[model samples]
Target: MRRGFLWDGFDAGIAAALAGDPDTARDHFERVLGEDPLAPGMVDAQEKTRELHALAADREAVAARVVHSCRSKPGLDPVRLAMS
Candidate 1:
């Protein structure tokens, strides 16, 4: 399930970011992007994670934004929300 994989990667990325590991977060976000670049918040998550990795600033806020984007994308599947 591509959607499931994206969710997993996104979740892992958020966890990594919250743990103050931007490199790992970027890696997970990039993996999600690889799976589905156009999937909802994939691009934003990847870009934000990349910035977090490079700038190393405000990681918690970045992670929170990533989680919000992933959860709040318009027209997202209700089933996917349940899955997460």
Candidate 2:
């Protein structure tokens, strides 16, 4: 399912961010956003992604931070992590 793929991608991005791969995480987050900009938690994801992007133009930094934050957090559910 497209939704499933997006969710998985989101999860991966979060995981990647927590792992310190901001670039990869950013890419995944971007992909998820692109897939469903109107999704429930897409707005938040978009905001976070944008922040990460602004934090570092380099993709690596973005991914790293994203993964790190997601991993450290307790309520980062990809399915519920929409833009709404």
Candidate 3:
């Protein structure tokens, strides 16, 4: 039997988020929310996806800052950050 379930979108969002594809995850989560914005749990999932994307962006920003810091500082290598 074929099914058109809302949770499918939610689950796909989680999987994409875990795979480091927050934009895809948000797209999925938003699709579910779009179906029923007032549905129980759907709102939460939407918020969670938004937060996850924000966090991912923040992490990338921090990493960029670290890389830039390493480049600007004298003889400080970001690769050494891994050794420490």
lDDT of candidates 1 onward, in order: 0.61, 0.62, 0.56
**TM-score list, all predictions:** 0.50, 0.44, 0.44
User: Model 1, 2-82: lDDT tens per residue?
Assistant: 564676776777677777787787777667656646665666666664655553344656655555655667755433222
lDDT of 2 by residue, 1-84 (tens): 266466677677666665667787778767766765666677676677566545544545555565567776786543323221
- Provide the clashing-pair count of each candidate structure: 0, 24, 0
In model 1, which range of ten residues has the least summed lDDT? 75-84
Worst 10 residues of 2 by lDDT: 75-84
After superposition, the stretches of candidate 3 with alpha carbons farther than 4 Å from their true spots are: 1-4, 37-84
What's the CA RMSD of model 2 in angstroms?
Answer: 9.3
Using lDDT, give the best candidate's number.
2
Where model 1 places Cα greater than 4 Å from the true spot, the runs are 1-4, 37-57, 63-84
Name the top TM-score candidate. Answer: 1
How many backbone clashes can be found in candidate 1? Answer: 0
